[model samples]
Every structure is written in structure tokens, then in C-alpha cells.
Target: MANETMLQAFEWYLPADGHHWRRLQEEIPIFQKLGLTKVWLPPAFKGTGPNDVGYGVYDLFDLGEFDQNGTVLTKYGSKEDYLSLIQSLKEAGIMPLADVVLNHKASGDSKESFSVLRMDPANRQSPLSEPFEIEAWTAFTFPGRRDTYNDFKWHWYHFTGVDYDAKHDESGIYLILGDNKGWADQERIDNENGNFDYLMYDDLDFKHPEVVSHLKDWAKWFLDTSQAAGFRLDAVKHIDSEFMAEFIRYIRSDINPDFYVFGEYWKNDAAMTQDYLEQIDQSFSLVDVVLHMNFYDAGQKGSQFNLSAVLDGSLMQASPDLAVTFVDNHDSQRGQALESTVEEWFKPLAYALILLRQQGLPCIFYGDYYGISGDFAQQDFRELLDKLTFLRQHYVYGEQNDYFDHPNCIAWTCLGNEEHPDGLAVLLSNGDKGWKKINMGTLNQGKVFIDYLGNSTDEVTIGQDGWAEFPVEAGSVSAWVDRDSLVN
Candidate 1:
């Protein structure tokens, strides 16, 4: 029953590391109480250094030291803490899914310092261990050099700051100048040679065979331990497509056959993200730039953050069965970007649409489950999660359904059983305020039940009209219908 709903808690249940073993011990019962079946912890493995975010892999074997200072000071904690957390989660029937970074690793700031040095692609000993001298290589040229993610574009524009020999490809790395002169092209680095090509983070060269092997080995170890359900692959698009495909295949062939793997492809449209999903058991469903822009405009640009008909339909077109849907994620929200932080009252509505919709595995962000930072202004988010999970089990997860959408609104209904005479319906309003009358094609009489904010269940008689009017609160949502109230 717990596995059916499959509630995955993001990050470790307690503060990561061994210090909170007792807290983890307490978490087992609490998670079970909350109907959660999985705990998705950030990479429990060893990180590069204090500043490393676990993705900057230093050693897969170093699980970290768990003293209080570990969580407070360093990104990783002690090995004992990780093992304990895994054990506890497993024993409580909650699977642990760790985030794995296979594409890149931590290296010395300078090309000379990196152990896996040498940019000559032919001379590289191991793709996984080898580092590149990216600082000297040319950075990606945007607009003109766009869409060359899989290939290399040396004509990058870094603001008129201290340029790194742009014309001199002798160093093997180039800079992509940006408006910020000093910070131009810092994120784009060489896959080999560890060139600081890109800004902020280091990018790895996935073309190397050694990098491929490292990813396979990581999958093997996790499956061998029988602790994790699968993995949430990070920065997948940055790596080669072939590498990702083979990695997914190896995990399935060598590890648990049913192991689940999802990638953070990060593109904004379903069309772009679809091919990546073909490589994994499941993936973030949609990644269209246009769709994301709409969300941005609606949510941030003095407009409502409502799902658009065009964007929703386009995403559904990608892969109805395998897409994992979400309202927002870590990268979606940034300074001056659309505020991904959702309104309290509107959360349930957004979730209700995804869970009740016909396509994609609905994924709820952490704050959506539990109100973050004591901003308990309104709504019981945790309780809403309980209801949402219950609905997923009874309706969304596996049921076949139909979708009806519009520019300002979207709604879906899934039939449970032929004899039931009732069904579950989920609806969302992207508009500011209005009452949308939906004619569900009049059917047999039954009470209509709506649980929008879970604040109250408004019941209306079907009558001969065979139609129900859904009142969508401004910037909010509602999920109800006469159909499957029996299950909840």
C-alpha cells in the first residue's frame, strides 16, 4: 500500500550525516506515518571539498564524516551516518534514491594541478578520471553558436573583461563573453583539460570512455547494496546522449531489472526532453523553452502563473506514459526569473491537476509538501499531500483517462471502473478569476465532491443538467467531482 502511492521525500529525512542517527531512527516511524515510501537523499558519497555540492565528485567512496560540523560546514557527512540512514529508510519500507554525478568531478583550479590532466583527447588514459585544461579552450558562442550543445563552438562571447587568449586556441579553452565582463564564460569549461570555459561550475568531457565506466560502476554499487530504488541523474543533458543511453542499459542489465532512473535533462519543452526519456525508465517529462517561458510570464511578469493549453498539450505529446511532471524545481527559480515559489492556496490545485491528469508521474517539490520557513500563512500542505497521494493511488498513477484543455483552463477525468458510474476529475485555472462551467456530458446521478484547497469539500447535485460548475479561486486550484469520493 505504501509503495503504491510512492511518496519520495527530497533530501535526507533528518540532517544528513551520522550525528542524526537517532533522528533518522525517529524518521522511520514518522515517514511511515506520513505514507512516504522513498527518501531521496543528496549524494551520500564523498564530495570534492567543503564547497563541493556533491555533484563535484572528488571520490565516490568517501561518504563523509557525520559530526555536527559536517552538515554545518561541509557538503558531506560521515560514512556511518549515510549507512545508518539507508538502513533505517529501507527497514521502514522506504527506498533510498541517491543523486549521482557521473559526468564531472572536482579538479585543481589550474590545468597543471589536475591529476587527470592533458587535453589531447587521444592521450587521455581514462575518460572518467581525466581532467581537461578548459581555461585555455574557447567557450560556447551563444545565439550564433546556439544549439551546438552536443558539439563544440569556440566563438564564445565573454564580456570585454580579461580575455583568455580568445584567438589563441593553444590553451585548449575559450571564453563565452557575457554582459558581465569579469564573469564572462566562467561556467563553460573544457570537458578535458579542466578549462574554465563555462561560468560558475566545471563541465566534464563525456566523450571519454573512463567517464562512462565510472557511471556504470556507481550504478552497480548502489544496486549491489540493495539499498536504493534507483537514481535521479544530475546534469544529464551536458553529457553525451550515447553515454546516458548505455549507462541506463548497464544499470538495468547488471543491477536490478526494475530499477528506476530519471534524468534532469533541463530543457524546457517536451519535444526536446522526449528523446532523453527514451534512454531512462522515466525522466522529467517536459523541457520546452516556450512552455517554461509561459510559466515564467504568467507567474512572474505581473500575470498569473497558470499552465497554458499549448504548453500542456505539447508536453503531453512527448510521452504520455513516462513523463514526470512538476510545477517547479531547483533551477527553475532564479534572480529576476519567474518566481517559482508557489502560493499557499494555489498549490493543491496545481497538484490536483498533475495527479489527476492522464499523463506523467506527478512530482511535488519539497516545500509544497511541508510549508517552508514557518510561512504557515494558510493551508495544511502536509495534509494536502496525504489526500493527493491517496488520489494518485486511487486514480492518477495507473488509470487511463481523457484530457480537456483551453487557453485559460485545463481539466481531466479518469474512469476507474465500468460499473462504478463515477469518476475522478481534476481541474486548474491559469486565469486571474472566473467560474468555468464544465459540461461533463451529463451522466447518471451522483453527488459531486470537490477538494480544492482541502479547506472544505463542496458537494453539489448532478441533477438532470449532468454538468458541474467549478469555482476557481484567484491564483488557486480545486480537485473534486462526484466520481471517486468513495475511495478517499
Candidate 2:
């Protein structure tokens, strides 16, 4: 199969207008031509209010079809518009992956009295207060759509914990009192802050059988309703690993055997990410946070960073098949909580490292492609990103040969195969303008090449030994292709 790329279709700062779905419908053809095979659409369900970006999930069943959350339509649009958008993507031969927020639920219907114990904010396992009765916002009765797709009403028993205590008028990690309740199998979770299970806003308890069954049932309804090919799970590290694996199994077994799912196992430690993958038997792909951190650190250090060790401890190195690699996303974009924007100068280099190489499946951020709005408005990298995707579609194939001998310069070539003969040569530098002699294979020994990235002006002919010197501008990346292919 050809290399596939997924584009995150929404940014953090997209306007709260109910026309995002329409906007994407029109833009699908443009990105499709640029080789976008998959799209990660933002959560389509209704949230706290009209402006809620779908992360603060109110009702999974009320997918902008019910008159709730102060508006009938979500930030994206109404249910009809969402269904239309999915159809448009399928018509264009692109797989749509819907974002699923199952870790927590927000904007409950009302507060209900529940027993709880306050745990230390830093250490989730350590109890800070004794068991006491507190009024918590853990009741979720979707009054708008009382018994539409699902009549399931959530109570305090459905969740393992709540953040706000309506009784004490305080906010803390209040572990819900239950027959058998605690952080869901701490060993399978990330061992940060003793236990990093509870994130925020009524953490759902997957151990509860009712909660588990409801979620599984909802998955079926969602897929059947939207016709999405897969899901982009939110906050999987905080959720139970065992349940996650089981949930994925149930989906593939009962729903779609080829249902593709990836999770936001948002950790920069590759080993930890792999361990989580192991607990789930490598069931799905995960965001390559380790690799994204590497890009951020390299951009921060510039020439001081080691270009060769870029993929050292990344999911791309450990498990390329299960790595959904990306440079930045909604949370990582500027002004967000996890903002660690890669420098503009290093953006091209970072993209080349992911998009050109035959490793992990590359994901392009919507912010980078369509320019961010609001307080952090910026220019887009549309032209260059489009070209890189074009290369991946037409020229990037075969075996890649690495030339990571230099500290400030690195280059690699994809020796052409029977299918894609005119392979690609990618060279990048973090410091001064550099040149590296890379062998293009004896098959193209006499072919002349030009820098497809427009970073270098000179053309060079490959020697009889199939070696050609490729030039890259300082602090930039250049992609070289056959001059004949460039013309035709």
C-alpha cells in the first residue's frame, strides 16, 4: 500500500461558528489532491455550550441533533452537517476518524449527593481527607434527548471520581465512594504523580459494568450513525488499559473488523508509551509525543541538537506501525496548555523528517496547514506541506539509505523500486549550508536532479557510482528529484 497521511482537520482556535463542517466539506477536494488519506475530525457531539470545542463532552448521544447545551448545533455544526461531511470525505476516498472523549464527561444535568474521599492533588493514591458526603455534579440526564438513541442516564456510580464538591463548595480530586473503586489498575496506567488516572470533570469508571456496556453500545451507535471509519480516542493513558483493549476488541469483533483506532497516549517517554501499547497488545496506534518533543527540543537548541538522535527513543523507532507521528496539534499549538511550538525555521525540517521518510504514518496539523486564528494567529505552511505530500504520493518509496554522519547535516535517499522508480533524496541542515554525497542507486546514475523544495538553485548529475552531492540551505531542508520527472 502507498504511504498514508492523516490530517487533523480542526485547530484550537477555530471560530465558534456552526459552519466548520461546511468549511471542511469545501476544502476536502483541495487536501485530497495533496494526498490526505485520513482526517481526524474534532468531537462531533454536543458539549457544555455552543462554544465548547467538544472536549468538554456533555452528551455523546446528542450529536448536535437535540436542542441542548444552549444551542441545537455544536461548534462544528448540526448532526445533518456532520453526516454530510463524513459522506463528502468517503466520496473523496478519505477515511474519517471521529474524536472520542470517553475519559471524562462535563456539564452534567444537576448535582447529586455522593460519598467521596479527597486525594492529594499531586498524589492521586494518597488520601487527603476522610470519606464524607458531598454534592457533586455527577448526574448526567440528557433531558433534551431523553430516550433517543440511548436512554442511559449516568449517576455518581458511573464515574470513579469528581473534581468539584458542591457540598463543601470546593474543587479537588474526590474519589467516588463505591463497592470496589479506586484508580483503575494503577500498574497499567502511567506512573506519573503516583497515579495519573483522574484528569478532570467526573472521570468515568471503566471498571463498572454498566459504564462499560453503555460505552461499548455508544460506540456502535456512533459508528453506525456517522459512518466514520475509526475513532481518535482522547486521554487513553488515564483510562483503564484493560478496558481499552477490551473495548477495541469488542469494536473489531462486533462492529467492524478493520476499524482503525488511535489513542492520545500523551506521554513523551517512548518506553512508557510502548508499555501501554503492550498492555493492550498493540491494538491501535498512538500519538508520537516522544517524537514531537524531540522536534521541539531540536527546534529550541537549533545546531546544538543532535540531528541523528531525532528518532532515538520515539514510537517511530520502537514501533513504527503503531506510531501516528505529528509535529504539532491542537493542544501543542501556541496558547494552549501543552504548547511547545516548533520554531518556524525548523518547521520544514521537522516535516521532512516525518513526511519524506518511510517510517510512521505522518499527521499534519490543521493549524500549520490553514494558519491559526485568535490570539495566536500565524501564517500557514500550505505550499510546502502540499509539495511534501505530493512527494509522498508520487516519488517517496523503496528502501531508504541514511547518511547521519554529520552533526549539523543529515541526508537520505529512497532507492527507486519497480513501482516508483524516480525515488526521493532529502537533505536537511540545522546550521550552515551543507552538502552530502548520497548514492541514488546505479539505476539512475546519469539522471540530472534539481531541488524540489526550491531551497537550492544548482542541479547536479549523479556519477557512474550512483552518488550525487545534494546541497541544503542553512537551517532548512531540500528534497531532490529527477529533472525529467519535475518537467513531466
Candidate 3:
């Protein structure tokens, strides 16, 4: 497989105008030109309602195909529009990575009386309310999508718990116990809330063979219907790792063997992420949340941040192959549930660090590239992202050398391959401006180098020993490519 760069093509604050899919279709050629190998599309399935962001998954089969949720179209456009967008992306040589939410299902059809015990939100193992019969909204018949795809009618038995009850008109975490019904195994999941299995609304019981079979069928159907290259699994830490591995294997075997899958583990600890990866037998890659946190800390601290320790305790440093590096995501964006937004000034440096390196697969967030919506209106980083992606596509290859010796500044060099002539030297600073004496490995001695990012206009000529003193401004990043390579 080729070194891939993915783009998270949607943000949480995207307007519910039902034109995202169409907009993606229109931007397919532009994304191809930007050298995006894959585009991680937002959930195309119908959400709790028409305006929902699709994370509150209602009907997996109903991808704007039926007249449900008060509207036939999703936040994105109709089913036909989504399929067309996927086809366009493929035609443009870009893989469409569908966002798959399988951990839970929300917005059920009706309420059913069931014996439930309220569990503490902080400690899910500790029950707060005694066993009592209450009318909970867990029945999902998909009345609007009546048997169009697979007729898997979800009931209270298919779920382990719910968060709300219509009878009391109150909100509390309730676990449906009795007859082998409970949360997933605590030993196999994150210790948060005892077991992090139950996230929101009707948490699907992966232990049930019938539920697993239905999900498997839906996965197959989704792949076949969308023709997506892979999936960006949502809330993997809350789901069973073993079940995830099996699902990935089953889908890969059933569909294309080369089908890729990555997940949002959302753990700040690299060890926990590594353990999850081990538990799943390395079936899927995970977003480098640890690295993102590091970037976030650095961005927040500004010039005082330690540049040398940027990659410390990061998955990219330990296992680059399975690390999906990203600067910001939907959850990490401003005003989201897991908001730890990276400062705008540090994004270019972050992008250069991830994109110009011969390491983890980098994902460009749409909020950064195209600017975000709502209260947090971000400045567009398209030009900077474009230059980095261009270098990544055409020049990033071969051996890498890390000059992470400076406290306020750090540098790295990538020796170019035969396919991509000339090397790349990257210099970043979170503090005062500085220069680093980097050796380009004598492959291009006496060659002139210029900053591809246009941050610096000065050029440096390599010495007989292939060493050049590269300078960058404070709180900025620069990528110096061979001057000869810059001549189109």
C-alpha cells in the first residue's frame, strides 16, 4: 500500500443544510489535487433526527433512503448524493473512508416497560437506583425504513442499557439487568466508569450472537452499498476489542482483503492505546491521541513549551505504522465534548511535523484546512496544508534523521528516494528564531535549498560535507527542499 494521507472531511458544527455530500462531490477534484489519498467522510446514515450529526445513529440501513426522522435526507444530502460523492472520490483516485458508529444506537421508535437499575455515571459499576420497571425507549423497528435492507428489529433485549426514561421524564444511566443482560466485560475495556461499554442511548450488546450477526450483515451491506475503501470506527474504547478484531477480519474477508480500518481509541495514554492494539492483534490503526495531547499542550504553552519532548509518549515514536497522526479532530475542535483545541498558530508546525516525516499516516482535519463553523471560526490553512501535502506526496520518502536536540526548536531531514529526487529538511520553533546545522547525507552536496513553505525567502547552499545551517522564525516552521527540485 502507498503512504496515505487522509482528510477528515467534516466538522461537528457543519450546518445541517443537507449539502455536505454534494459539497464533497464538488471538491473531489480539488482534494485529489491536494494529494489527499483518502477522505474520511462523516456518517452518512440517518441520525436521531434530520438535524442530528449522524453520531447519534438511528438506522444504519437508512442512509437517507427512507422517509424517517422527520426528513428523508440527512445532515448530508440524500443517499444518491452520498453514493455519487463516494464514486467521484474513487474516480479521483481518493479512497472514501466511511465513519462507522457501532457502539450504540440512539432515537428508538417507542418505549417498553423493563426492569432497570440506575448506575452511577462516574462509576458505572455502582448502582444508584434499585431495580424498578420503567418505560424506556429501546424498541427500534425503523417504521419508515420498513424492511428495505435487513429487517433487524432492535428491542430492549438487544441492548445492555439506556440513558433516559420517558415515564419519569428524567435522565440517568440505567442498566438492563436480568437474564444475562449487563455491560460488556470490564476486564476487556477501559476502566472509566468501571466498564466504558455503555456510552449513550441503547448500547448494543456485542455478547449477543444475534446482535453481532446483524451488525456483521450491516457492515457488509454498508461496504457493498457505499463502496468505501475502509472505515473510521467511532468509540472503539467502549466496544469489545476482540469483537472489533473479528468484525474487521470478517468484513475484510467478505469485501476487499486490502480494506483498511482505523479507530478512535481516545486514550491519552500511549500504553493503553498500545494495549488495545495488542488486544485487537493489530487489526486496525488508532488515532494518535497521545500525540495530539502533546501538540495541544505545546500549543497552549506557546514559546515555553519543550520542543524536544513533542513526540514523547506518543504512538508515532513507538509504532508509526499503526499511528494515525492528526493535529485536530471533530471532538478536539472548540466547543465539542472532548475539546482540547490546538492553537491556530501552531497548526502549520504540527502539519509539517506530521506530513513531511516518513512516519505515521497523517490525517488533515477539515476544520483546519477549510476553516470551522459556528462560534469557533478558524482561519483557513489550505495553502499551508496544500504545500505540506504536496511535499508529502511527491518528496517525502527514504530514511529520516531527527535533530530533536534543541529545547525551543527541533529539526528533521528526510533523504529523498530514487523515485523522488532531492531531500527535505524541516525546521520548527516554538520560541526564538534559530538555525540548525543539519547534514543531508552527502547525497546532494553543493546544492541550494529553498523553503517550500515560503515562510523564509533566504536560501542556503550545502557544503562539501552535505551540511546546511537551516534557519526558521520563532513560533513557525519551514520545509527546505532542493532548489533544483523547485524548478518546475
Candidate 4:
């Protein structure tokens, strides 16, 4: 079981003044103090423009290095600032996980006439328009970058499809056919729209050897330049699974053998995620989207939600080792796509489950830690998260025993270890005030325990049997640790 905790260092709503990397550098010490072992930084490359959130990738080689797309610095900061941020994180004993966007490239340099078959947005297999010539923005020379790192230029031949035509001012999915280049195999990807291989502007043709070679080179360059501990591959479901597996193998073998890699599949079905994992030869971990959806559903339903079934149909439950558990991410937060924000009241309980559990590596979102600006300014879980992080760092270890017997209340205990010396008892309730009797192991016999979260003021002395009733408030969660452990 991996015990390290990761913190997402950026949110979607962060100020676009291009100073995020500087701020992250300043907060490195604070992150270390919070017991975060790894920090996941947002995309460091220049996006479509100055205000782009780094997702609308224009130039992969330009990490805010040149004055491209009307900005010398990205939304986060300049290339120098990004490198400094990674160095600062390493110095603070936290590994930096770089966000890698490899699905598609956007913001072309010019337009070109091409014959394409328009496909239905709903059903990509079905054609909507006949093969017609139209001016599409598919040429990317990166003139501003001027061949700084890699001089590879992209054109329509390197892509599988496009979504817009500049001449007709039309918006539709156009399948770029010819030269044996097309969308990835439908059988290897999500079933949505026949095939989800084409996501945004100028989808890269993974079938093309040149495209794969260029991407691999870029990956090596990225790792060498940023010195990131690992990669967070974006939109894996939209890319070919075989290509991803090959990419991971190439990067790990040629660059960093022990490099960690995880992907964002973004499917609500655990089976789909598992299938993708199998397709990738289980080479990388995946964000547990199913678990996140469960959290969202539980938060929306509140007390009516069945707490006992919280882990059902979740990737964490099915494959804990390969699941990166999280409550909310940038895409799930307000004002973004895939918005399924967990209710504010259930955040503490959610964090307790993920952080204190033995299964799944927990990821703390920056939006949840530092409140979002604008409409969601009042929502901040930093204090609670701090407490949870402290408990996770100190007491979340050893073997675990679950007591998930109730529909609205559930509890578990982590047996004490020789290193930590004391164990933890966690209790949660979604309906009303409740308690569960859990064994903290025979080693904890006669020890006094109190809720570290202060949810309950009462102290419970463990009987000789080493079991005690842990109580939590209605619609809340608590972690009970040995009182003596606090002093040492």
C-alpha cells in the first residue's frame, strides 16, 4: 500500500496574472509542513493564448519561453519560474508531478484546404456531410518558438481530424481520411460517440509513426527539462491505449525507469477504467473517476445516501493499488466541464475516508484547500484538511479493519505499528449521531483515545479487549487517536 499523499497545486479559477508558479514556490515549505509527499502541478507549457488555462495547448516546446500567442509567460508563469517551482518542491521534500496534455494540439498558425468527411457529433461513425474542401487551421509551425527545443512542425497530415472550418465558418467533426491515418480503434476506447479518440482541435494520429516518435521525444524533453518526478497524462481515454502503453514504456525505459505515470480516463464506470488499465498492460495508475462520482452522489443525496455502499462500483474498491482517489478536481469544480462538485458539508467526511484509509493514494485538490475565487469564495476546507493531513502522516498506517455495516454510518480502525506506536479509529455518519465499536488491536488495550478532530469532547478508555465505541456527530466524521501520542 502506498502511503504518500499528493496535493494538486493549481485550480481552474486561479488568477490569470501569470504568478501561480511564484506563489507555489513560496508555499513549498507550507506544503511540506502539511505532510504532502507529492505535488501535482498544472500544465507548464504555453496554451492557446496568455489567458488559456494550459489545456488548450498550442506549443509544447514553449514553456512560457517565447512571446507566443500574445504572451511571454503562460497563465501560470514563465519557463524559468516553472523550473524554479519544481526545484523548490524537491528541496522541500515534495516530488513534483507534471501534468502532460497529449490528446490534441490547438491554436494553429495557418489554415489549409483539405477534403474531409463530416461526422455526427453524437455518432462519429455516421457521416453528416460529404467529402468537401474547406480551409482548416491545421498548420502549426510555432514561429514564435523558433525551434528552441524541437523543430518538429505539425500539419493536417499529422492529424486524424478537425472540428471547425475557417472558410465556411462552420463547426462540425471532420474526419481527415487518407495516408492510412484515422481515428484510433473504437474497440480500445470509450464507447461514447462511436469513438472518443477525437477530442479537440487537430487530434494527433497515434497510428502515424512520426507522430508517436515526436510525442516520445517531447516526453523525454519535458522530463529532462522540468525534472518532474512523474507524469499526469491528460485524456487517456481519447488517445489509443496501445500508444499510451508504448509511451509509458518508452519514457520509463529511455528516460526514468522508476518514473510514475497515471492517466485521467474520466469514465464514471469502473469496468471501463479497468478495461483501459488492462489495455495499457497495467503500466500506470488512473484517477478513480467512479469513486469521485460516488462521492458526488453521496454529497448530493446527503443523509439519504447509503454510506455502506460508498465504495461500491468504485475503482478504489476494485483495484486499490492502481486508483488515485480524490474528492474533486479542476474539471469537477464550478464553471468547468465535468462539473460534479461534492457538497461542501460532506467534504470533511470525504477527506477523512480517502486520507486515513489504507487503500488508494489520496489527492487533495487546490480548489478544495484554498477556496475558489468569485462565486465559490466561501468554500475552503484547508483547516480540516490540515488536521487530516497531520493524522494521515502520523497515524494512518499498518493493517486496517473495516466496520462498514450501517447504511448511514460507517467506521474503521488502523492497527498500531511499531514505527507509529499508536493506531487510529475513524468514524463517519451521514444521517445522525452514531458510534461503532472497533478494535484498535490488543496493543492499544487500556489506552485512552480522543477524537483528534474535536468532534466529540468525551475521552474513551479502551477496555482490556482493545475495543472502544467511536462516536461522530450527525453528518460529520472524526478520527480518534491515542491521547498520549499527541504529547510525543
Each candidate structure's count of clashing pairs: 54, 0, 0, 0
How many clashes (backbone atoms < 3 Å, residues ≥3 apart in a chain or on different chains) does model 4 have?
Answer: 0
The model with the greatest TM-score is 2
Off by over 4 Å in 2: none
* Clash pairs (backbone) in predicted model 2: none
Clashing pairs in 3: none
For residues 143-232, what per-residue lDDT tens digits would candidate 1 score against the true structure? 221332222222222111111332333332222222322211212212333322222234444444444554566566655653677677
- What lDDT score goes with residue 225 in model 1? 54
For candidate 4, write residues 1-488 as lDDT tens digits.
Answer: 23689998888878899899999988887898788888999998888888888899998999988988899999999899999999888888888999989888899999988888989899888888778888898999999978888999888889999989888999989999787966788877777988888898889998998899998889888889989999899999998899899889998889999898889999998777888899999999999998899899999998889999999988788999998999999999877789999899898988998999978889999988988889755488988999999998888888888999999999988885777768999999999999998888788889999999988888988989987887889999989999998999
Residue 313 shift from truth in candidate 3, angstroms:
1.5
Give the per-residue lDDT digits (tens) of candidate 3, residues 140-243.
Answer: 99999878888889989888888888888988889997687888888678888787888898899888889999998998888888899999999999998888
lDDT value, candidate 3, whole model: 0.89
Residue 100, model 4: lDDT of 88
Worst 10 residues of 3 by lDDT: 1-10
Pairs that collide, model 4: none
lDDT of 2 by residue, 291-402 (tens): 9999999999999998978888999888999999999999999998889999888899999999998889899999999998778987799999989998998888989889
lDDT of 3 at 244: 91
lDDT values for all models: 0.48, 0.91, 0.89, 0.89
Which structure among the candidates has the greatest lDDT?
2
Per-model RMSD to reference: 10.5, 0.9, 1.2, 1.2
Candidate 3: count of backbone clashes, pairs at least 3 residues apart or interchain = 0
